[model samples]
Target: MMNACPEKVIRMMDDYLDGEISPSEEKELKDYLQSCSDCRKIYQELTKTIAFVQSVSHVQAPPDFVQKTMAGLPKESQRVGVKRFMRHHPLMIAAALFVLLMSAAMMSSFSDDQQFSFTKQENLVVEGQTVVVPEGQTVIGDLTIRNGDLRVDGELEGDVTIVNGQYMASSGVINGEIEEIDQVFEWLWYTIKGTFQDAMSFFGGDDQSIEE
Candidate 1:
């Protein structure tokens, strides 16, 4: 699609779409666009892509997603085509990012309260979706909190891991490591490990494993 137009015409087309072209340049682009069917088709597709992404994919953006995604916009002068395409299609990126983050939050396993859906040991506070380790108490075993946040105000003698959640620690002491999983890939890794932790352990996998 990019090679369908002459390089100069492609640059003018991008400038025209972005409304940054001078009046004389605008006239030149308009005349070329009128005669170039391939460029016209590409323009229409770009307009449709923008319209669909903006109108259909109204997303709740993740924190810092805009800055991170915007920072990825192509900048190399040799990649003007890539830069133009990414610049005009930012809503698409936002929609995809929102989907990934939301999948972690609203996934079925997290929504279900069944113990098999998640994992935990005794001697902890459970309120709605959150799990809390009260101050002055100590947990003897590994801790896993799924689809919810963990407030750790006590000492945990074993590893602390969370899936699709946040971990907040207070002045309490934890003798083991802590982890937070906010992405689908990490969640998948935990799910697989939880399902096969024993089998993996038999093959030399460490005892430090995700429960669910």
Candidate 2:
């Protein structure tokens, strides 16, 4: 019967078969293998297994495999269209945003520069220039002015609405609120609302006058 070999000799059997061990270690393992039948059997099994794996046929994929796989995907034009759309979508959105911003800025600038004035009178004077409420003057009812500076030196019994102009009030009395419309959007909204109200008032006043 063959004697049991050391664990180190069994571990070195594969390394020795592969010529991976140092010369001294290979010599030691070879000497032990010659004396140990069990270790020799293990080494023969590992050597046979490695030879079998190396001798096996290596199968390759078909030459058209890659072409067939790619053919199953989207066509070049379809992919190009998608990529082109994706590339230009941001530019289109940016251009639209730029146009909107420019439009808003233009409207704001136009509104700021646009000129308007109220009817002139002794108590309420309006000119192409600044509107000045002379000192000690008293004006009744709501006052609306546009596109001109307002210098209030007297007393007003109603609200003051100024558009696209500065309101300078020093030692003046306003019995109602002071509203300034400086932006295009704000001025547009106020003008539309005031026009509607005036139309409604005119119709209502006509009905009242007819009834009277």
Candidate 3:
């Protein structure tokens, strides 16, 4: 009706019932509903459901519960001081600090220059170099690279491929194929480029040295 699909109109019912539909659409729907008996019935049912659900939310808590609970808490003059609060909640405070630090580290990782994520390889390894990936990341699918080396310290769900150099996994797992080329420089270049990129990304800029 009115060049609008039934699905779209149904989905917009929530918005329309709340009087949130734009004026143009409201007018169009109203005009269409005047001519469409099915849509009018659907609208009436939806309105009834909304009213019934809202009415069911009329509930009350036990009498004087709030007042009795407040009576048990110490008055402001007898409340624990800040020093006592810290002394009694050391573990909670430390846990909060740890969460804060972890959150900051996660945010910093987005800008790290040497940032690296495992890439999926689709082919099997024939002949290539090997390198190792460090711990903590995960790869979800098979990985194959031609003329490249890989080291695995993280987890992989796919096979691996190296065309030339070496592939070493001190830890982490690979579930797929790996293939690569056979060149020492390939590994070196990849390592160097990846390192700098990760470093920059994590640290936020290439202008500063490690000491800075």
Candidate 4:
């Protein structure tokens, strides 16, 4: 039998076998192992056991495993149904919420005594708080104004549409038809349809004119 080593040397030997010791600690453990036959034997047994465990634990997945497992599952149509349901549920809820909020806002505005005024200043078309047309004494394109009253004191070469508000033309020349939309629902529908048309025109490379 080999001579017994100290408990401290055995602990250091275990640390060295596990590669958990610093270089200096490893050197100390190596020196001790060379002098202590019992510790060296323990280290040799630990190393062999670890090597055997690693060799047996290395595993590779079979090539046909995924294919075979998927073959037993349900069709993609069933999964797509669930996915579409999940996707559209949120969109439907969001759409409903948006409609509700818009309705509330429109109702509140309708009840209020708020009045909007539009004016032509130099080359700028001032509508309420926003300035839309800049420095064009004469508008050459179709002018569509929504959610406010419109007053034109200049010349327009194209059609004019006023939604959810009144239209007043004073000394202004309109070369095309003037449309007035006062119903809230009609205005909302027209706005939404116009937006969709604009998006389609942008993506489809079409030169369709949409109401602004």
Candidate 5:
């Protein structure tokens, strides 16, 4: 029978007995407990119940508990063993395949040269450009040299055409006709051919002789 109802103080007392009150609230409970008998009684009962539960809830394991559990299994079973289970779960399998493909590509990049061969094809040489035909080369389609210099020592199964450029064919055979823009190319061709021919004729005749 406290003089004041002390509802807020009583609330703090309940929270404190349950260990739910903060330090400030505990101070309030202390001040109230000094003057309140009914709240003190409730707090003492809650503290006793909490202590009893904590004292009885924790227990030590019996000595024979583990042995009793182990003894429940069969002793003479033959195939209770385990093997490695490699679960090729979808994501891991895809990652493994991708790594393998990248490794193969990296290895192939360091390998020998990759040559591209196009058979039964044409050779088109551009103007002011130098064309080189490798040895044992053969073209079945028509060859066009447009204002360019071509060195054709390879075999061509079809015609060879030029437009205003030089054609230096050395021992290669053309099975079809050879066409050109002869009006413009003829002057360049004659200039070069005449210079070379004059040099050769001068050496062969008495006009010029090779000196030691």
Candidate 6:
């Protein structure tokens, strides 16, 4: 908002939302909001957010909620036990996590075996790191090329998935999705997300929007 609402008007808007603004102040705020789209947008957003919260029925915790929670928690003397344990034995925890991460990464890398790994060799030509679908050749079934790039100068009847690689789509007819995935880190991230989402779906939870 290059030209912002006056500070007094902003305070008036807040007061108006809270039902504490004087009649004159409320009029001033409305007049300013009508003229300034920037302030009006902000005010509209504030109204939506506030209205959502305000419109909800007042909910009270169960009678035993506080008691149950307090009973489950440790006594004050030992409340900081976990923190103290972590502080004193950081090395052990760190070592275990480091080993686990390394083992998982190693297993993933070994399983990948990206040395010219692919699915379906028919109708495709491999030239070093470049996989090519020559002109006039039509390949059937999905083609997954790992640790390599693909040049599609011909027709592909199914999906073309490139792992840790790139592709050049020229004058070719691709009948399905052409997916390009980068190396280990990205693959690992997607694997974890997929697993988590699967678990959530299984439990009837909505898919979470988790981003890199």
RMSD each, Å: 26.6, 18.3, 27.2, 14.0, 25.4, 25.8
lDDT per residue, candidate 1, 1-212, as tens digits?
A: 54668888888877877879999988887788799988778878877887787798567879999999979997667667655554677556445545555454446555452342235666788767777778889878887776787776877788877776777656777789888877877766665555454443443442232111
Best by lDDT: 6
Error of 5 at 83 (Å): 7.0
Worst 10 residues of 3 by lDDT: 122-131
Which pairs, if any, clash in model 6? none
Model 6, which residues run further than 4 Å from truth? 1-106, 110-114, 193-212
- Per-residue lDDT tens digits of candidate 6, residues 50-137? 9898899999999999999999986776646655665677567456655565567557765775576777667888788888888999
**Where does candidate 4 stray beyond 4 Å?**
1-68, 71-122, 127-136, 195-212
In terms of lDDT, model 2 sits at 0.72
- For candidate 5, what is the lDDT? 0.58
lDDT per prediction? 0.69, 0.72, 0.59, 0.64, 0.58, 0.75
Model 2 lDDT tens row, 1-212: 23376778866875776678999998888888788888888788888999999999999999999999998996677766655664557456445545565566556646655657753545975545677777799888777777877777887788778877878857878899988988878966665565555555655565453333
Per-residue C-alpha lDDT of model 3 across residues 6-59, encoded as one tens digit per residue: 776665665688878988888878887888787788889888988899889667
lDDT of 5 at 25: 82
Q: What is the lDDT of residue 142 in candidate 6?
A: 91
TM-score, candidate 3, is 0.30
Candidate 4 is scored at a TM of 0.35
Model 6 reaches what TM-score against the true structure?
0.40
In terms of lDDT, model 3 sits at 0.59
- Which lDDT tens digits does candidate 5 get at residues 1-212? 64354789768866876779999989878887878887677668778988898889667789998999889977744332311111324345435545555455435432411321122255533223655454577767776655465666677777766655556866766678876644634534544554555544543563232121
* Candidate 6 lDDT score relative to the true structure: 0.75
